[model samples]
Target: MSYLDHCSTLLFFVQHCGARGRSIGVLWFSLPSWAELELGRAPVFWKTMNGLPPTSGESLTLFYNPAASNLAPNEEFGIAFNGGFNQPIMCGGEPRVMRIKERGEADLPIYTIKIQAPKYAVSLIFSFTNGVEWDGPYKLQFQVLKKWRNKPIIFSNEGLAEELSKEGACEGAIFPDSCDHRELRN
Candidate 1:
């Protein structure tokens, strides 16, 4: 399958699993080598903090480094979430439209948008975007904020488990059935 096809498949799965009340702790975006060169490195989870409660008009803000890899003199990069096409949150400068792909399955519509030359800290304003109120029991919080220096944040599954443990939220963590050892041993 083509790279775009692969992305679409993965996105569909993520949305599907999320619809089933599964909170995706980590998401890996597989970009083609060329796209990677243009978009920089894979996304890293910087930090997770509390946001406005459900009752509040606005929620959490997720600050992340959009691009940590090297970029050409004027090369641009941007990220699109599964939601409405609203104004981009300017961290340093305004967002320029790169591309937009409209797609739908059954009755669900999806739009893939790419922004050119976005700020290092790209803020996803939930209040302005269109989507579900929350992902599973957790409200959709976390906004991206710009940093003085662009440094990549590295994290692992173990680190995530530790964070959850510290929060006392890992007690009921569920392992996927696909992780069963019987098939692996076979």
Candidate 2:
């Protein structure tokens, strides 16, 4: 099967297995360096964490979604995350989804999804349709706030925000320190 097809199937399994409280041993693969750069800049993988997790106030909004106008034909999207012990598994609870829409006349379509994970660190994987046939499977990593309420919480992608961002939502967040099979690559 093609690499993208394989990734789609694996993501499907991950989602299904997660829903059933099952864990799978996933193998890791590497993509070409060019593909890695492209995946990093894709708007579909653009993420932002609006505020700190609540200690007892209004919930913080986490934005994870694709940009509508930038989608290529036959595009498919999937997301997976390692929710810290205190958080719910991916797809476990209701998350507010924002559909694709145009932002004014700029033609930059904005799509956003909001999820709340209180008191837990999260490691996120975003998968998108391959831009090149032989680019192999491509995925990018980002994480939510790892330290909450002055306490250090551990998750898969701990202390990754520094490498992925210099400013914006992911600043000071956590992410995987290295690329491996668990990453979204074929």
Candidate 3:
């Protein structure tokens, strides 16, 4: 096994054994460097939260599903968005996901997601219903968003907004890695 070297994203598995089950805990996000990342929306959040929880409250854990993942064969690894969190074991709550559609220069197949955290929220609130259609093999490079149907309320609960406050979405998962569970398996 690889010892904890740097701080990179750690895709974990959700397993329940002896009733308690094991949570793949905080995704160890080891960034390359400060300048290399866009870590601008973290600070103001208050609470522990992860969009996709390990245990679904019913003692059921969410494992990584490879088949449902989207991978870029050209790229070495898959990158998914992560909802803001203060530190390991603590979640920053749900973020604001912007649903953008460009027109002329707007229709250039591009979009943006933003975020902000509220006070006293225990989990991240999100809407998986927002989606973007792609074209060709390159499309696979982008991960599929669940487009959470109920986003407004989710954000409100966590003090996150889809309006002027900010716009963004956290990374999710990729293909091949068993840690991804966007789509379930039989």
| Residue ranges of candidate 3 with Cα displaced over 4 Å | 1-26, 31-97, 101-110, 122-186
Worst 10 residues of 1 by lDDT: 83-92
lDDT of 3 at 21: 23
Between prediction 1 and prediction 3, which has the larger TM-score? Answer: 1
lDDT of 2 by residue, 53-110 (tens): 2222113322222232233322442322223212232222222223343346743443
Instruction: Estimate the Cα RMSD of every predicted model relative to the unseen true structure.
Output: 20.9, 15.5, 17.7
lDDT order of candidates, top first:
2, 1, 3
Model 3: residue 1 alpha-carbon error in angstroms: 28
- 2 against 3, candidate with superior lDDT: 2
**Overall local distance difference test of candidate 3:** 0.22
Per-candidate local distance difference test: 0.24, 0.29, 0.22
Q: Write the per-residue lDDT of candidate 3 for residues 1-186, one digit (tens) a residue.
A: 123211111322111111122332333222122222122221111111353222111111112111122211112221222233222122223322322323354222122333222232223222111223111110000011224223444553344222213322222211122233234221
Candidate 2: worst-modelled 10 consecutive residues by lDDT = 129-138
Look at candidate 2 and tell me the lDDT of residue 14. Answer: 19
Give lDDT for model 2: 0.29
Per residue, candidate 1 scores C-alpha lDDT tens digits across 3-98 of: 633343333111112323455544334322333323334221111123212111122222212232211112232222322111112111222222
